[model samples]
Target: MSFLHLLAKKSKRRNVKLLRHLQDVASIAMKIARNGGLDERIAYIGAILHDIGKASTQFQKTLDVNFRRPPGMVFRHEIASLFFLSLVDEQDRPAVIEMVVAHHKSIFKDIGEMGLLDLNDRLRDCFEVHAVGFDIWMPNALEILHHLGLKVNPITKEVARKSFEAAVSYCEVKRIGYSKWKGLLMAADHLASDMESEVGDILPKLFITPDLNFYNQQSIWYPLSFIPGNDPRKHTLLKAGTGTGKTYFLLKRCTGRIFYILPFQASINAMYERIKKDLMDTDAEIHLLHAASLLQGNGESLKEKVLQRHIGASIKILTPYQLASLVYATKGYEALITDLAGCDVILDEIHTYSEDAQALVLKIVEILYSLNCRIHIGTATMPTALYNHLLQIMGGKEQVYDVSLPDNVLDTFDRHIIHKAEKIEDLGPTIRDAIKDGLKILIVVNTVERAQKLYRWLNKENLNVDKMLIHSRFKRSSRRALERLLQNDFNRKEKPCWVVATQVVEVSLDISFDLMITDVAPIDALIQRFGRINRIRNAHTIGKYKDIYVLPPPKNNRDARPYKLEVLRRTYDLLPEGELLQERKLQELIDKVYPEIEAPNIDLNAAFVAGKWRIRELYHAPKSALLDKLDIDTVPCIIESDVKLYELADNAIRLDMEIPVSYKILSFKNFPQLKIGNHPFVIPDGAYDVDEGLIAASLKLESVQ
Candidate 1:
């Protein structure tokens, strides 16, 4: 048989044998490295030598179906790849070896297991066939090297041998910056291995900016009246009221690939669809990325989804958690960081995140700044302190284009009349009256328990109106369905319904209502909830149905965990009563509610420093098979009560039904009950409601301990 043909990789799943998957990886790695402006030759060499150990007969036998594999025999192909490093020059061997070993796992972690501590026995164990003393794989390795146009240099052979022998005691590999060089090789390997089927590039080719001329010329609904008019290539800080075309403004200002980040999946999904529809030009691909991104019927094949990770589309509408991969150093985060460098990012609705998330968001800003990303922050409720901090990071006000609506323009956009009450229970009669009056109502609570309770109470009252309840805990499929229904139902001109929800409805969802009643939350969150009411206004309905009812913080301190009680109290005290909610006062109110720039109990600088250190520390560590552990915060789990229901889940479609069980929930001992096979189920029967979603109390299951 020919040497090149003998070096082929046989895939049991696929019906084709490649000359070698390593060659394909090398080809792809070279392309990626050149595109990233790194040395393509080094990348190709690293890719070619990465899996040279698989050429061994013992490894080949392990691939045979009928072969009896030994129990304790572990074939570390990566370690074997280093044996042929002598084929390369002495100057390039260390970097090439780092790429080979660090591709699958970190070199720092697997050094002992890889046998750098005992070179001769390790070489014998890896290369010598069972019961055979001589290395038989060397001839095939030489054949493969000859076929790849690489000649073994006699001078470097002795040098490589000395280097390898010296490494038996201690191996010191040179530091290749984590985000670029090594990351590029890993990304190329992943992209090549996963690109099983043929697919076209779906990346966006959009460069046309959405200036005032485009908005005025394209449609009458979105007139260019109250948004920042700046060049798409500059850094921008935009402040505009709700319903003022902030999304349009952000999109219009992006000159390259865009990462439109929002706080909620509901919001991100909404933005994804909105951008996809508005652009409807086949020039660019707009992808929605979140936990349940695949489940959203985009008709993306498994191969396409995997490809998109390495070669991102023109625009990605995702939550900030997706960017958290960089901080966590998740596998393939290198690809994400590469995609994000020098890209235009829009951090929309920046005021709606939690304390921890808010801290992470700031840290992300720091990282993106260092990566030279053009960040445009848009928020209606941004505090002066936070804006100033971001401005300083972006090279101060001179570098950032500050965009805000004029006082008269802001007044014209004023559409909300704010009012406060001690409790929502007292507003039951008023809510019933509004339903009779045919006003669409939005009620937002701090917790799912509170939302479900409010939903049931209204149901028991026999309020004759259509009701839809939404929260975070619903099955992935159910939440998606409800979100679509809510969007469609609310858009209908004559629909007068009640949507009982938690903070899920705060940002990104395009639905607007005539009235909103929400529990006491942080001032910024309250403002975000208020944005949902009187959100879509016109000349005829400028100030009509602009009423919003806010319940004051509870007298008891127990309910304050979801939000700071002091902040809520201060926000409630400062809100205008029976008067137009001025947009100018938003920053002042936010500053007052959050006296310190950082949220209480969150040290932003400390978390950022720790994250920076961890990224550096993990650069040489072995790759973890469990990527979920590297995820920033949440843990996704399959939740189902019935064994039959869980059994019905086919492997292909099961991910659509999975839900993220927060880390806080999993920390409790025996907290979740019922397991379908090996996967943890968050609740048993009666916990997940078709309408209200997975009840918060049901997550605390305790039994069969």
Candidate 2:
């Protein structure tokens, strides 16, 4: 076969087309423009021509999938791109070059001279060009051109002059001086292929199909049948048991489209993998709203361009915060929210919100409704307060379907009896006993600190930890590594290992822990935790001692203590031994135990007036405090607040799926800049850091502001 055909076979494995590398530049240009870096449209065109070198037959063969950088190719590609642009009209060269030079995440170097140009309204002109050497191409650009049957000189000093002028203009506007001829080509070259659109694009398109068994049973059918295709007159609420497939129904019920909004990154990855496996066979183009969703691809140029088009996607999976970016950060949120309009939303884990967040959700609900969006709530034990809040927000209970009760939620499965621990120390012993009895146990705590403590204690006694503890605070890559290990061989394994975790395991980590020991928060929450146990049908046998244990509360004393570190308030009333509560007891337990009712402090009647706090703040709570309240790993992250990220999508620069994330907390250093994902975000108590830096608990913001 010809070399080009071989390339096509290789390219066939990669999603998207090759010419699109230029499109990555176009996206970067728009990002620059929208960000007010440069006024010239020509810069945008320059971004389109920047990666022309990738078209070389020689370059494509040299790429190895091991993620090694292409040797000596960055400047060659840049010069090739520049030479291609030079072949275009002389006037169009500047805008294109600006896009090209800055496409590899270093355009801010030009912004120092532009002095923070506000290119917002009508596109403004890049006034002054900062001087940088432009003669950047190597011997191959000329040699490859000669080989390709085109006559071209190595980009000359004069041609480099114009390119350098445009490149300088880019940095001046971003206001930060960039390194001169620093590994930019290497940076761009590192972004080797168009892989993001492959599985990354497949995730949103996948959905769970409601089985024939689901409809005959009210419990299964009600939640499983969001049926976004139906009348918009009714609001939908699903309170089915786990393994009843709350997620599947949420995904499958879209009428014209579906939006699966999950609470955590693990869920995001799991859901993405599921959708890619399931729906990618169909015609739909999928989109992921979260930053991770955007990063998982191979062809950097192809991924970059697809990200720019939003891929005209039919399904979008995301976190609520990505949507919140609209009201808070730079322009990226605009695309996310507009996409959210007019779609069916299966909001999983609706009970996870705080009062402030619930209020904000109410506002977002109104916005979605106003835009004719459909809403579906999926949770295990629907919190009364949250349900009631939705009732008031979406109109009323009768107006929305009442598929919340266990009888109506999903009839396909029987409820597993849940027990409450009489004391805290009973946990390790109980977990150990469950494991010895061949039951895989899950120990979920409300805090990462508590989870770590339990895992440490379990290890001290040498109890199995194969699935011990997982939380948001652990390194992201490491967390992913562990989840992969636990999921594949969970059931067929030997010793019982405890997965001590925060809420991260609750949503989408597919393994069923034989039993769970957890602290209580809300009824819906408790039910969700229960979902992780006995998930599949034929869960625990009748004679089996396996069941969930809600840890006992600390003795109530009025010393201003923090309520015994999330000790369940009405534990005695909810469960007695392995016996399930009877109906009357259940009602009383529901009313008295869970905090779903309007907290006395937050008025339900007043409703949120214009000035009332919003739901977006759920993501805004502090690290320590948030850690105190929920089960998540505390780590630094370089959020997409960087203007460069948006610039690539905007100006059409190539997208590399492996965008770096800080495992520790971090702050944004500049627009398009975020804290790297491997370190703790350095945040001060009094001063602000970057656009959307690590939001420390001490610093409070009322809204996305």
Candidate 3:
């Protein structure tokens, strides 16, 4: 066989001869394996043989325009790769075979049920004689191996059959489980496959950062700047105030690729811009991930999606839940986990998630810790119990860099005066008075229905201020418009206006108000809400300490599904009324309200625990459907009357018209939906006011009755 005849097909990303793919992948795997302290030779050999099966005639024919495989002759080159494992040393054979067979598919799956992966049945026909000649294709494969400086004995029917049996035996031994070598092979293959024509441009290094100190120009608070930079070998946990430069602090410690996680999309969108503009000193690549990642208007091209998922980047700004897909072992989880292993993960605003989400976050921390990832957790509010739990997860206190802001640094950020209110409506006079005084005011409600109701009441009063309303229920396009307005006008506004919002405004938008009125929530949540008022830490402002009125929570448990009534009561009682809201008091209040770990229900936990030991679970790439059970129920919907909006959604350029509403009010299965590409756009037969957003169809039907 000719040397070139043994080569695999050319890569779609670059025009190099296919032989280079295996060599490049081996080089990268060696580097990664060495970094993780694993046997680099095993990694190198695993990568070298991963795609060797592609040298078979059947696979090459698939590349031919006029050729097709004979009926019942399926192409499963990953399985075919096992036929070449005879070249590997017996000691390294298990690792190499595991990486080769599972490179494209799972080794632990029900191979007997999979048509292509069922080695016993699928191999018989391929090995059988054809009209032209004997169908054994190992000659070209061995020639290619020899060209690459490897020697393999001749392939006989008995030798090939024995090699396949050895591979299956290695998989049956669960002691091997998931290995870093396998992860490295997956990462290396993706990186090599994505190399653009010039292979020299893609280096064997880990990640890139600018040489200059990016933090020197900003006036960093004490302790924040004083904390030692991260040691990639250890884990880190930190607590600091809102305006204390925590984001910059965390970025300073990152040694390799970064995964900066936040809770909400609005926060992630805002952070994506901040990182790109301020933190990026070089032309380092970065990607934004969320439900709207595929949205077109964000300058996202189809090519970028391929590059982002496989080629990866130096940094990625996303929600923690995006990384939680690994727990479910979702499709492409291996690639995601490979990119994350040994990387710097900055988890911000971790206290804002729901109970199930919180459980999932802790699971993520446990998994990332096992994967040798450098975890840096930053929080503005964390209960002592939760802090201790995280420390335990990192192997007691010794293994983690436990850092917090000094008292002097914390004292400077004390900017709020708290007051208790009998009812939210009772604060209407206070809001009107603040508006009359030409003070920019922000009112935060616990629910979307309440936010809309309050907005309508305030508009009817006609307080003569430019008023705006925002909540999670607004369409994606409308929410973006509203966020833009908040950033442009209210963020540093010279004029007075009232912005009524829900908890969506709590975490990441850069808007500061002269005064705030909010419903009673957990102390941690309340602190996040209070952050929006006087957020920039301007000490000498006209109103040095802004006023915040906390309305009592709903009287009954039924109306308090969004928040825990007991926690809210404790939060209200512990807050110092008629005095400045000390950031230091936040920890004490949070500890009293949430002392124990919050996790998903018994059933969900059981499901996760049951699959924990099943090796097949790791290979099972489930869909996003797994998230439906984990997330707080919300459904994506569009207003039925908006024809132009539907057309825009159909084009899938921007999802500004799709909004997420409570699934409790709308049955997910009953909605009349349209599939635009991968996204499902639902049309609800309910009155949708520009200001109120989507009214639940069930509510509309009840009204009609």
TM-score per candidate: 0.84, 0.56, 0.80
lDDT of 1 by residue, 1-705 (tens): 244544334442452223456666777777666555668888888787777766666556665668786776665665556667767776776557656655665444443454333334554633332212114555666667666767853323344345445333224433334536556667766666665433223212222222223332333334334444565436888877677777777766766678889998788878877877777754566667775445455465665455434544677778887877555454556667766777889999776777667866877787788777889899988877888877887777777888887776666666788887777889988888887888899999998778889889888888777888888777677787888888887646665688889888889888878888888788888888888877776667765647888887877667876777777788889888888888767777888877668643333322235224344321433334223333344554554444456567643255456665565666664544334433545455555667777665665454322
Q: Candidates' lDDT values, in order?
A: 0.66, 0.47, 0.69
Cα RMSD to the true fold for all candidates: 4.8, 13.3, 5.4
User: Model 2, range 1-705, lDDT digits (tens) per residue?
Assistant: 121222211343453344343344344334434332344354444444455545544444445465455553232334334435444466654434543443333222122221122221112322112112223323434443344334455665566456545544444444221221121222222223333224334233323222222222334223444433243445677655566556655554455556777777778767766765566456655555554334334333555334422523556667654444322212222233434555677777755555444444555565555545777777655556666777666667755665644553333444456776665576667667776887787777776556666766777777654654666543344555556666767644755766677777777767766777787655545566666765555434323334667875555543212132232555444556776533224434555666555433322322223433332210111123333322233333322233234334422221221222333223334222223322223323232222111233333322212
| Candidate rank order under TM-score | 1, 3, 2
The candidate 2 region of ten consecutive residues with least summed lDDT is: 614-623
Model 1 clash count equals 7
- Over 4 Å off, model 2: 1-235, 291-311, 327-330, 395-414, 422-424, 427-429, 464-467, 492-495, 539-545, 554-567, 571-573, 581-588, 594-705
Q: Which candidate achieves the best TM-score against the true structure?
A: 1
- Top candidate on lDDT is 3
